[model samples]
Target: MDRTTDTTALPLIPRAALFGNPRRAGAQISPDGGTIAFLAPRNGVMNLFVAPRGRIDAARPLTDERRRGIPGYAWAHDGRHLLVVKDNDGDENFHLHAVDRETGAMRDLTPHGPIQASIVKLSPRHPGEAVVSHNARDPQWPDLYRIEIATGRSTMIAENPGLAGFDVDEDFALRLAARLEGDGSQTVLRPDGAGGWAPFMRFAPEDAMTSGVLGLFTADGRATLMLSSAGRDTAALFRLDLETGEATMLAEDARADIGEIIVRLHENTPLAYGVNYERNRYVALDPAIQPDLDALDAAGIGDWGIQSRSEDDRFWIVGAASDTAPGVAWLYDRKTRALEKLYDTRPDLADAPLAPMRPVVIAARDGLSLVSYLTLPADGGSAPRPLVLLVHGGPWARDSFGFNPYHQWLANRGYAVLSVNFRASTGFGKAFLNAGDREWGRAMDDDLLDAVDWAIGQGIADPSRIAIMGGSYGGYATLAAMTRNPERYACGVDIVGPSNLETLLATIPPYWEAGRSIFTRALGDPATPEGAALLRERSPVHQAARLARPLLISQGANDPRVKQAESDQMVAALKAKGIAVTYVLFPDEGHGFARPENSIAFNAITEHFLAAHLGGRAEALAAEEIGRSTAQLLEGAEILP
Candidate 1:
């Protein structure tokens, strides 16, 4: 294994090749195992393409969506219709659409206006029905409804009873619900059989996000697979008996928590559970699936992403991807033990010089382990090169090793890329996650700073030339880095980052009402005097006058989570303080840039901005590029080359 960083000159991979939409993606097998459906462009917009199983060339467009392509769709139990989720102008108010495969007719099941919806349970027992959660009645919390796919009729099954979220069993029975206490703790409830709810489990504020029910057992609906770090250092998987409240450990990882579980859809039993340390590794619980896992491991195609399998379990659709390679979809014949390639997401990158991502564990200032991934450039000598501290959003999310175009773009432009999993990041343990509580701008920002110091200490990053960039919570981190430690970074890029904690909490979308306790726990409640004072102290908008470095901020005008007002006030504050800042706004985007043209346009400007401040290579943006995008230059136009 070559851990040495590449320093030789290589061909420049085009920005379009890296950032452009894939030719085809999200290929899946229908439930009945007779047909296959994938997402491909139709009249330049992404739409569903259906074909017979095992035949990729014969795929045809099933749905014709003109404005924004269908982002995701799933096969219904009957195999007669496809359940599709879509949003308008990136507002993220998802609507459930059922497309009749034979007639290609689409019906909006939940036609309610501007509300978030998600598929809760799709049971094989009820072929014509699905349990979905919609935030129609209340803007903040989602209420459960049983929707009939055939007639588009919806009936309220169990209205959300002020819990943050709910989990259902295979029988579509409400098994678990989590309620956030005022003290930042979480109480898990189960049906008491007397038509009321009984407390099943409880989690302290520090263990709130770390411990929760994964799902109820499909076998009996009386047992649940849960993750808890109550008396441990890391969150581990356990099977809990609903009747006795006794838990038995199923799996435990010293360094990481259980990331995902692969369950047998029909039986509702977990087949394998995955632990994501540096990369993802799966543990097979059922011996029958071990041979398939062995076959996949022997193939060495790349990290496997199993998409779907036939109802009879004969054929499987999987995707293989790596940090350097885009992704190659495959179809595996389980009976024959054969693997066939479907399509390479980006064949242009087949022979391109993409940087390799290396996982390293660094220590924070407080000696806590900080898991991180780093990518270095492939051009010439490396004498402490300029570094791009790429922070992931989801103050709750952790960065993993994968095919990241942003990392490749930065590395190709002659900058070292480092993504750190700060204290509050998930997949670690309750202790690490709790460390981030009420320490958003304090300890969370410290972990990033410590990462920079470690990078410089290892001679992989130049101490004098480093830039911080991220989106969502990452975007908030970018602003915090610039305002809190102005002399540390040469520049910063924040995409859709909340500027004011107080305003951000105040304006959170209604559907997030259930999770308000988590928010109040992480960042103090702005409604209270102490919480309000803390939020004000951590808000970047109030500290904008302290910025001494150039900053590039991007936002989707229709972002529902972090409203456009966040960027507006941040930019206004920077302008009032006479600070140099570049702001880009996309009218048709939400949270992040989704459309290809907007993504390319933003990257074009971002490249130029990074180059101007950090002396990195930047692809020149042509006039035609800007003409094709809907991006508006809010301010700092001079930063564009």
Candidate 2:
């Protein structure tokens, strides 16, 4: 077995190049500022990678081959153990585990079958311990449980029937518990030492005007920041004084949806939080007062965030990215504003002189504004090229002008891709997001059509060779577009998208029990006859018989949100009608591909599918570029002529 094999003989990588996949998350900073940990897929899957603190430190893998969705882990107070959580069953039941920093000791904290738990906080005083939240007692709601690191013993700390979440402060204390009421209202209950509960803030159903009740980001002693989705107002961040019960508006935009910060490096201090508004924008927590944010901002130099920040907060890290540079590691200097390149995530893509992402604002047929990102072939835009209408998931999620892999892939293949931030998208005002409510298969799908027309109007897209692709909500839209309005898209690709809105709303996982509140507001009540009918009318499945174009569907076998049955039903119905459809399922993945092999494999399959139909280019598949699963898909697929 020669360690040196011919990588060139294969499709993607050099034999000498590192195999397996790199991590998907950014590197993390240790509380002591002496080390950093990041996600890296070493043996064909993603895991944690740690490195010593300094200008130069060789990174080492901290976590071995493990299950996915463990991004919700943190370091204990002593920073000697990494507390991790994994969802064993398909229902998203999480089990907590402890990993020792010095000896890489991996131990399960919760051993119950299909028991669901979450790591709420790491005790600052008790080195290798953490405060966990689980619904072990109640399947409907969760409470706090203190877990001992060495032993798998858990003690009941606080139990509240209405508790939805718990947060511990820097002192390892369970300071706040967010309880959800039946009426979609919320209450913040503070922990009283006497084991009593104190109400700090209460949000009523009518107070939907100020959803400041969405829970607050309570730092050790800093004021809490609430992310509110007030009516007709876009979601924004608000600062509430925990002492005075007073709230101050920190950031708001009637035209933008604001996001909040849940995690920060070192003492979990609030540093720079990110908000994807009208475009991609990051707001630091007054970097002037705290040099850490500024230093972290400059960590790798440029505007990139480093894997993590230091404890003392002298030097900060920023991750760097560009059109040509998918993700490059850099160290930025706060004092001198100097940027130093550390490593490039995808060095093999150096020759990809990709074009920058540009913003475009077009009026919906109804005169409403829609924001979109326009990516064209690098050959100086003006020419009309084939177009790919890339719909994004979370129709609630906005697409800013940035480097998106899918967008680049489509553009690189000589097709202009248009990703529209339709009305339901956040970052805009509440009205914009609300405009998308209940419009799923109707106007929302219209917005996508309108975007294609805009590309035609801009003379950038060849209307004849148009295609549409997306996952989840986007996948739903892809099917809806082909079903609701048949002649618009030449080809449709749905990835883990719901075929029926009613089924999706009803079959939601237990962990997403609270999502019903927001879903009801956005999608109406699915239990009611009227809501059921409307959802059916808007469902792609209900209109599957109307399909006239080729379709490609991909789904995760264990996806809790978008059930595999969604894809199964759609495919069955389509094939039942004698329609040609391609389907792929990854048993090891969840909602999205957590492993790089999955991504590269899916990308290769998608490219081949698109090229043969759209008459575009398909980059030669490579072994190291992905895994055997990816190559298998391309083996028999018809390549572009």
Candidate 3:
């Protein structure tokens, strides 16, 4: 395979401009509505910043994290403190940190190293405390605790006792838990007040993921908001009575599962819930909030989300997103029905030409509906152009309509990007998700091939110029596409993808032990001889000798999910087979590139690789660009040049 050496004079959007850290993003309002808090760069690192509600310009930094940035945070009921989650050097063992906004003091609430902490519930009734879960006691399951914000003290609320999840009410009290059974089913348990728990409901393995609790209803402790796929193809939002096991449907979509619930902070009442099939759509449940929803819809710029609301629910900090416009924040004053533009996430791309992402549905060879998003180059004529078949990571996760930086970057480089939600994608209900079970490289890969054929039939993609690229599971699919149908893609790129399913399952993080049964049911139970043979048959590493196209691979050294060994073994196999490949490794990152410099460098090399194989436009990698990041080229050194 020969690389494309011809260079075009098209304007090159700098890699840093697309992949560098956002100046400021994710703005939210305080509970009292007196101040707003958001993430912004402080000393070259992202930190918590707060400002008065009406005067966001006076925002000041509250945390001085210098290495990795805070991933997420929430305001405490008192408004003077906030809870944040951050992982060390991308190891993914997140620690909960409580910060004092007044004195800029911070304490690690869960200081146990490599133990993940997650918020189970939070309420104004417990002003300076939150129900948190920590897996320090057991790597396979987490135990619940009431963590105090003021003293960083923790009181054990509920021990894991071999349960998968603990359900809490509006008062931050644990009421129910889902326990994984030996048969891969789940038994929902309710506490009997005397410390013993009894089964309330049982879900078969097929229905476990489709049916789950949202939270206990604020109006009635005995009733809870739940999602159930029982007696239906798609999951629906329902108010379920715990005592009688009766349920009433609230909001539902024929084609997708019920998504997240939007709740009022103090009152704990649900305002609306979300559904995402092609794009995200909200179903308003509370009539009082309908007018505010209408005003946000009328803004008509992009998808709007309520970031934070005042206690009285009069003022809302909203975040708007569009395919062309990555992000923009607004202050929506509900009383006046006005949207005041606050800031642009990427002001540099404000004027850059971006392609429109259109949603399309194509039927697979097996007649399954495949929902996909396509973004074509702005200047590329209505003819067959180079295509990048970008697959999403979660075979369990679905791709939605949104502003994706990768799609924009590839489109600007003159390639049509197609991201397909193959059969197993969520939100489409239980049947579609179930169809992906045990079909890893078979029906799943066929669906991707069918998508390419559809694009070629539509004259939107050049069949001879198509390349496959993805991360994680999508990365595994990239390897599968190249090996199973070597004549299809011109080249391929895989990031943090597992090559051998057997080793992949065996090396899963210890903390994921509780969910191993789900994986076994979804893929193959590698613990059995039959499952071992099936996994080996589907593994791309075992079929490396059939590789017919060049490949680019990237892996993070510290990735906790898809370990670096996955990439190493695949590359070793390819090397032994004398197959063409480039491998890049990041020393200071995990699952994916978290640091701005590492992200920029990875994308730069990737752009260079795509241009070499597909003849697309690329910003030539400069020496300084390569020197700035921690990315080390392990093989195929020509990818950067």
| TM-score for each model | 0.96, 0.85, 0.97
Count backbone overlaps in model 2: 36
Q: Compared to the true structure, candidate 3 yields what TM-score?
A: 0.97
Better of 2 and 3 by lDDT: 3
Clashing pairs in 1: 7-380, 139-510, 139-511, 140-510, 140-511
Model 2 C-alpha RMSD vs. true structure (Å) is 6.0
> How many pairs of residues collide in model 1?
5
Q: Choose the strongest candidate by lDDT.
A: 1
Candidate 2 segments exceeding 4 Å error: 1-20, 23-25, 55-57, 66-73, 87-91, 123-127, 172-175, 179-210, 213-223, 229-232, 257-275, 282-302, 331-340, 620-627, 630-641
Better of 1 and 3 by lDDT: 1
Task: Name the regions of candidate 1 deviating beyond 4 angstroms.
Answer: 1-8
In the range 225-310, model 3's lDDT, one tens digit per residue, is 78888888888888878789888898889988889788765545678988888899778899977887788888886997778887
The global Cα lDDT (0 to 1) of model 1 is: 0.87
Better candidate by TM-score, 1 or 2: 1
Instruction: Point out the worst 10-residue segment of candidate 3 by lDDT.
Output: 1-10
